[model samples]
Target: MTGGAGYIGSHVVRAFQQAGIPPVVLDDLSSGHRGFVPADVPFVHGSILDVPLVARTLAEHDVTGVVHLAGFKYAGVSVDRPLHTYEQNVTGTANLLTAMADQGVEAIVFSSSAAVYGTPDVDLVTEATATTPESPYGESKLIGEWLLRDQGRATGLRHTSLRYFNVVGSGTPDLYDTSPHNLFPLVLDALTQGRTPRINGTDYPTPDGTCVRDYIHVADLADAHVAAARALGEGRTLEPVYNLGSGDGVSVRQIMTAMADATGIAFEPDVAPPRPGDPARIVASGELAARDLGWRMTHTLADMVSSAWEARRAH
Candidate 1:
């Protein structure tokens, strides 16, 4: 697994352990914490761009597949540093594929994003919808997917790119995200820290005027990761992509209200203008994954928020 030390990747690692499937983790510790990973699990501290190190790590682990999660993920950051985003996301992905192919590792489950959809006209975006990535970060993920799909076709590398929406609600309080990228943690931290939780906008067409996004529990998404890998490993057909989401949209105010109700804390939202290129709403349809992987979501909107708040307090 790459980027296994980040918020989503670390949870994926724990889910692998829960399923009795151990994975080798590769992280540069650029934004990820080393203490998040268990000591018994073998971890290589190196960038994916390091070709020699990647090749060596694959051979040492006997890795036949990967959960590719390492990359710069912030939409705003990508905008601020397009070149850096392209280099880390695009070049790193190329090197990962090369190292994997070199070692004859033919299966991969890529950690894609809902950002690929951009601002869809439809409320619930399915896998069949045409991709129109809005930002550099989204563009980088699209490029990564294109590379994965094309490479898999040429090399018989069975692959699945799970297009994930908002991945919130950390199961492990010890490993909550400190990064300023993710929305849920950012809001929770701002509120808990006594700083005002800023709402991007209050003038969207949505009912609450705040941008609405599909929030899937990290654990649900993590389970789908293993299922995708297993399906590819079991010689399943080359359907290499699937949308993974709750199919339920939650606005910013709705989330804040829910957390406030649950925690008995008044959420003082600081309404600010939406950032440029901010999509009004992004909701996804995950029927394909549900049908094929038998995946079901366990958390509700309240659960997702309350759990994050609980985890935050614990930390």
Candidate 2:
């Protein structure tokens, strides 16, 4: 698994270990922590852009398949750093695929994102949703999917991309989202620093007025990824992409309420204007993942908050 030392990647590493699959991790530690990777798993400190290193790792481990999760993931920042985003996401993915081809590793599970469907007109996005990415991050991911598809046709590579919505919560107390821009960490950081968590806007058309989005627990998302990898390894015909999401979504106000309840902080959140281009609602249907990959929303909204709080406190 590439990027196996980051927040989501670490959880997926644990899941793969639990499933009795030995995982070799390659990470540059740019945003990933060395401590996040299990001591037993073999770790290679390198970037995916290092094609020779990637090829060597695959050969050394006799790697049969790959779980590609390494990339520049910030969507808002991607707008300002388009070239950096392309280099990390686009060029990095190309190098990894090239290395895999050289080493005869034919299967991959791609970590895609919902950003590919930027500001969609539909209420619930599906696999068939027309991709119109608004940020370089989303565009890079879409191109990554295209690369996988093209490689599959040319070299008989088998692959599937898992496009996720907002991933929150924690499967283990030791692992949590550390990104400063993510909502969970931002709220928890405010509380820890003796400040009130703030909501951007609460006057939208939705029932709660705050933005509603699909937030899936990271552990559940990891499970779906492993399922996809297993299907690919077993040579089962799989779709090119699947959305790991809840058809229903939770609002930002709801998240704040859950945070207050979970952390025992009762102060009302401060309100601010909505961020530009912020959509009022963005949810996805996971029926396809459920049918093929055992995807499910195992954690409730309250469960997501509490687990996340516990993990944040531990950190």
Taking the tens digit of each residue's C-alpha lDDT, what string does model 2 give over 248-270? 89999999989989999887999
The residue ranges of model 2 lying beyond 4 angstroms of the native Cα positions read: none
Residue 45, candidate 1: alpha-carbon lDDT: 99
Q: For residues 160-221, could you state the per-residue lDDT of candidate 1 as single tens digits?
A: 89998888887777767677767787877777787877888999999989998888988888
TM-score per candidate, in order?
0.95, 0.99
In angstroms, the error of model 1 at 47 is 0.8
Residue 180, model 2: Cα distance from true site in angstroms: 0.8
Q: Which ten residues in a row have the lowest lDDT in candidate 2?
A: 293-302
Q: For model 1, what is the C-alpha lDDT against the true structure?
A: 0.86
- Model 1, residue pairs in steric clash: none
